[model samples]
Target: MSKDAPPHISGTPESSAKARARKLRMPPLRRRRLEFDDVNVVDKAMMKKAVGGTVVGNTMEWFDVGVYGYLAVTMGAVFLSDADKDAQLLFSLGVFAATFIARPLGGVVFGRLGDRIGRQKTLAITLIMMAASTFIIGLLPSYDTIGIWAPILLVLMKLLQGFSTGGEYAGATTFVSEYASDKRRGFLASILDLGSYMGFALGAAVVSVMQLLLSESDMVGWGWRIPFLIAGPLGAFAIYFRLKIEESPAFQATLDAQEASAKAGDETESLGTMGIFRAYWRPIVLAMVLVAAVNSVGYALTSYMPSYLTDSKGYDPVHGTLLTIPVLVVMALCIPLAGKLSDRIGRRPVLWIGAGSTIVLAVPAFMLIGQGPVATTLLGLLLLAVPVTFYVGNLAATLPSLFQTSSRYGAMGISYNVATAVFGGTAPLIMQGLIALTDNDMSPAYWLMFTSVAGAIAVIFMKESAQRPMPGSMPSVDTEAEAYELVAGQDENPNLDVDSLPFDTLGSQQGTQSDADPAPAGTADHR
Candidate 1:
């Protein structure tokens, strides 16, 4: 009759024997006590280094992206001198999309490596590959010199950039998310994008300055390579910062746990590529849809807009590149604010604002850009930047929460890059091809609207992770006092679901005997 006792049965002898057999066969309900050692105390200095290193490398990665995007037209001319205007442009955009072709492979390889070796080591390798490839692009000979080899070489370099980049963002997000305290994760993770757009704005600024200072012929002749060449030094600076930082505490703890389990003769199943797909497919699919939506808008704003402005809106390349710089700078500055707001309100609400704004503003934003005045174009860009600020600022923090710490990086790499390859990287080509086919300048707007709708729907299914510990990790806090507070209050804390922690699941798998008996089945929360 006690609340904690097992259910009583009244039955015939045969039925009673069957019931007892069933009870004996059932697995025990696993549980553990919350303890101080389970809480991760945030080291402030290490947290700062982690954030700085990750953000700087992210900036460099996006800087390469910005350079390639802003220079698409010029590169087309340089690489395909015999092609007509439209052919040249199309070829260039196709090459940009081609970069993403290699990203999924990069994601798989580096994702697995990061999970196996360490996030820090894998990230360093990716940065080196990306920087080296970008620098190689600047040194490539023109189409006039290399005949067919020019475009071929260009495509190869872009693919390399894409390959390296596949690992960069996912690893960076995983790293920073693991380093941050639960309450400030949103704000801290948002700093990655602040660096991202700042890198973008810096690239735009560099290209614009080059365009302004040089004649059109001079730019096509050699000036365009300047931006790509800049990656060498920028990458070195980023790598320096990156190498100084240590691995994230959550990942380290997971590694340690795995080692200890191994030493005890408990073999945990490794979630390889197919295993990850099997175990976390729903979250993987959900993450893909969300990524598709966010990156569609993102690629539209960063990669396609410059070409659109130049080709359709009748702005010269100078003004087209120049117009986006201010908008990017303003957007970059506001990213952290949006991130902080997510921390205060919740991630879903902030994401909803992004998705809703995209749906509402896409048409008007395009219309303003279509008007062709300088002021109208800038206004339109700012309108588009609104949703982007909300979406990208929270994405790094949000996506990593979907999977457990054991497989977060691998799952993210697979989901994010696959979506980006399918939808994000190809946005410019798709938008441009749509317009060419239908002659609708608003085609890109409709695409943005569609993706945002999908994104909004995805948000509905997402678990709210704001101010909570990441899955498969302990409650992370900034101070020892906070750690004590968390441990004491954990039973009543809405965010701290101690029953659902990995220890229970892992312990159950070990079939390890324990002195304490399991809780009764009906009383346990399975997940």
Candidate 2:
């Protein structure tokens, strides 16, 4: 079959079905998916496959991301000078953040490309970009051989990686969630974070091994690039596997419908940045908030933790890795569980748990960890690790759901990039300064907690898509209220112990404080 040929996706609703034949010349999607006899609802099996693909793809991308940050300490000297080590490291991190800044642009570019061409194609190209750029970073000339251009080239490569990463997560999550059966989405979507943690674990292991193999001089001189070189083959390997996964059923259905209805007099708005901005700015803003919350915490732990421990807590770098291994492992294990629970309960409550706890725990955990002995630090980290998992695992599906698929890429890509660039990208730098300003007595945990508070507040108003009408099924009959309404009343559902979930998370305009409180433990939403 041709690469673009539709694979059999098991269960997509017949969103385009017409009541009778001889429909007036309608939009292409209305005619194709709606007119077809084979269309059906997306079920759990297809949802599982969608999630599987995303996990594999994200795993590859994140593996390299984690490896780079972990190894950068040993390798920092290759591209920088002794006189300016601290400044150079900061510049390197700046380069890292620079990549994040480009994500939104990539989102708009790749997202529109995906909407116009196909999600699978766009995704494949992005994976290629991420792997290829990371690999090339391994090959770049160092400061000793070249000069300023080396760092410039390094920044360029980072930009490429950032741009591609922008669309990868949102595209994969949306692709998976949109195809999932209604109740299955949160669980399956959480699989994305599982893949992320898998990458994190592997990256940690890879760098730890590299640290053992090479002396500091050799590692800084040449050995540092080898991991990046591995990414080239790794990217190719991931693409090979990704090729086997099915295209998003929703995207595929749209493609077929769009092609069928393209003959003449179609009213579908072409997905352009301007078009996306005009229609989806609000949801786009929400998606950005979602990415920033988890991403800020993510960078703090994965990227900043090594330094945080060594600089602030008086731990050795290699030992810090040993300490970090458990935290990363725990986070990996918990993310999927949180995601599955979200599927069973709902995204809103999962998000509430994640954001609320992070806000509350950030300060206390940091303060205690900073003051602790090795065991205490580990215990404090154990506590910190819990809430981070909740946020990362659940945001998998929640961020993408904020925008319509028609413009999801643009919305999520840009919003995530822009928000992270402003907040998450600078979180460590700013937090470090805040601690220094406070005479190094205060914990960044509190700063992280405070930093994440805005995001938690932002999430309070986030839209829940749990009961969103399945794609390929009827367009919402009550479009206006359906679009804004958070919940379909469950007063009649026998299983719903509504009182157990105190806040009006059912799309009610409840304040952030009430919306975020976890239900007494053992309830569906809280559990």
Query: How many steric clashes does model 2 contain?
Result: 15
Q: Each model's C-alpha lDDT? A: 0.87, 0.66
lDDT of each residue in 156-239, candidate 1, tens digit only: 999999999999888999989989998999999999999999999999999999999999999999999999999999999999
Q: Which candidate is the best by TM-score?
A: 1
Model 1 weakest 10-residue run by lDDT: 510-519
Indicate which candidate wins on lDDT.
1
Query: Could you tell me every candidate's TM-score relative to the true structure?
Result: 0.91, 0.80
